[model samples]
Target: MSRGFLPRQHGAWAMLLIPFLFGMFAAKPVWQHALLFLGWLLAYLFVYAFLQWVRTGQIRLYGRPLLLYGALLMPTGAALLWLEPGLWPLVPLFIPLFLVNCYYARRNRERSLLNDLAAVVQFSLIVFAAYELGGGSDWRLAAALFAFSVLYFTGSVFYVKTMIREKHNVKYYWVSVGYHLALLALAAICYPPGLLLPLAVLLVRAIWSPRAKLTVKQSGMLEIAYSLLITCSVLLVYAV
Candidate 1:
């Protein structure tokens, strides 16, 4: 397979997989969940290709991926919807968020914090879709999962900017630290004790990682570890 056939945004894979898996594990797994995940993955690939084509305006470069992923996604999506009509309600929620992404892509401002948040919200909402598909009935748990995913990924947007695009911008660094600290405070006040561990870890990294001057690969590795830790913690607190 060509490199273009795959998404180049490595961080996005975590965003894509963690919430879906979290929700799936939160409830009983059914065969339909498998189909749902396949459709979900294909949809993301299709969207990524579409956005790249929008941003670059280079049909010669992005046209193949656009056509291939879109073609693949259509059948998978149709099948999932046909099998589970319950998912229809989620379509409205996804469309606006997707349009936000497209808007930013067209303007080449895809890295803006607002655009990042829109993407985070879209990815985090997958938790609900997965939870529903898995027969999860606990609305409270599903909502909490969504909130946690959004909170973590949003902080990730700020932290990543500090480490890369805004490396020399102290204001952005402090904003990242401040955001994590606020989350820590909120966890202390309202969340379960179990959540504090992951929140504290997030805070520590938000404060220390940039100062340590880690390379992009190192930073990404740490994010993967953090994502796993958060996923495990959520499963222990809500699923088990």
Candidate 2:
């Protein structure tokens, strides 16, 4: 497969999969969940390729992947929607967010915090979509899971900036720490006691990981671990 066929953003894979898995586990899984995931995966690829084309104006490089992914995605997505027509309404919610991403990409500001948050919101919305796909009935739990995904991934955006893009910037480091602390506080007030453990761990990592002098790959690996921890924590707290 061409590199263009796959999304190069490693952290995005976690953002894409973890919340969907959390939602699937939160409700009763059906065979359609597999189909939903495939369509979701293809959609991400299609969007990534499209964004690359927009960013660089290198249509020749990205155009093929964009077309191929789109070709694959349309039928897969239509099939999923055909099976569960309820998903039709969720499509509109994503358009504005996608436009935000496109605007940033066109400006080559894809790393901007606002653009990152927009992507986070899109991924977080997938939690609800997956929840509904699995026949989840508890609106409260679905909404909670959506909020949790947004909160954790948004914190991740800050923490990762502190680790890499803003490593030498003291103000951004504190911003990341403060955001994580705020997340912990919010979780304590609004979430179950079981959920606090993962948030606390996230806070600890935000404080300590950058100072630990870890490499980018090490930081990424730790994030994968943290993502799993949060997923499992949510499952134990709400799904069980």
Choose the strongest candidate by TM-score: 2
lDDT by residue for model 1 (1-240), tens: 665678878889999999998889888778998888888898898888889888889788778888887888889899998888888998899989999999999999998889999999999998998998898899898898898899889999998898989999999999999999999898788678998989899999999999997988888888889988988898888778
Give the per-residue lDDT digits (tens) of candidate 2, residues 1-240: 576777778999998898898889899788999999999999999999999999999988888998898899999998989999989999999999999999999999999999999999999898888899989899898898899899999999999999999998899999999999999999889999998888999999989998999988888788888988988888887777
The per-candidate count of clashes, in order, stands at 0, 0
Error of 1 at 158 (Å): 0.6
Q: Which ranges of candidate 1 are over 4 A from the true structure?
A: none
In the predicted model 2, the residue pairs found to clash are: none
Model-by-model lDDT, in order?
0.89, 0.91
TM-scores, one per candidate: 0.96, 0.97
Pairs in clash, predicted candidate 1: none
Task: Quantify how close model 2 is to the true structure by its C-alpha RMSD in Å.
Answer: 1.0
